[model samples]
Target: MNQRALFAAAAATVLSSALLNMAPAAAQDMGKDMGKEKCYGIAKAGQNDCANLSGSHSCAGQAKTDMSKDEWKYVAKGTCKQMSGLTADEAKMSMTKKM
Candidate 1:
């Protein structure tokens, strides 16, 4: 193959590899958006994004109570309170109440 053709092939291979390597990171970042915030008392039972503040479980989808006060879910930035979800302070209050 011509030198130009060889160089083009090599560049294409490199670019494809780079894009494959970036796919997972991009997906993870999308899941954990920089502009989003974790809103407590919003996730239904078995719907939390991850572990709970109370340490009742260490994984997602393990919440024992619907809308548990200590659990959190990622919500868009500045939309947590507007969604009727609890702020950190309100969540704390709920934590003190009987489940």
Candidate 2:
């Protein structure tokens, strides 16, 4: 195969592995005082405030402000898949670069 194609394949393989191994936290916490999807601490970026929990690296590439509520949901879903090493601050800025 060509060099470009080989590099692409390798990158895809690495991405697939990271995604396959990652686990996303739920929208609820064990404590009843916290609101639904709020206690988990993984807010939908600009949708709400969060203390910044651990998550995946791929989330660093997601967009911060979406056009609508539904779009935001998809954005958050993708962001949640990132590894535990990912930080909300890093993700917030990276996704906000476009707007």
Using lDDT as the measure, the top candidate is 1
Q: Each model's C-alpha lDDT?
A: 0.77, 0.38
Expressed as tens digits, the lDDT of each residue in 1-99 for candidate 2 is: 999999999999999877644522221222224321222223345543312332222232242543212121222333444522233454555456645
Q: List clashing residue pairs in candidate 1.
A: none
Global fold similarity of model 1 (TM-score): 0.59
TM-score of each: 0.59, 0.25
> How much is the lDDT of residue 14 in candidate 2?
97
lDDT of model 1 at position 36: 79
Estimate, for each residue in 1-99, the C-alpha lDDT of model 1 and write its tens digit.
Answer: 999999999999999888766653453355465777778988898887776777776566678888777988878889998977887677878777855
lDDT of prediction 2: 0.38
Residue 42 shift from truth in candidate 1, angstroms: 1.0
Worst 10 residues of 1 by lDDT: 24-33
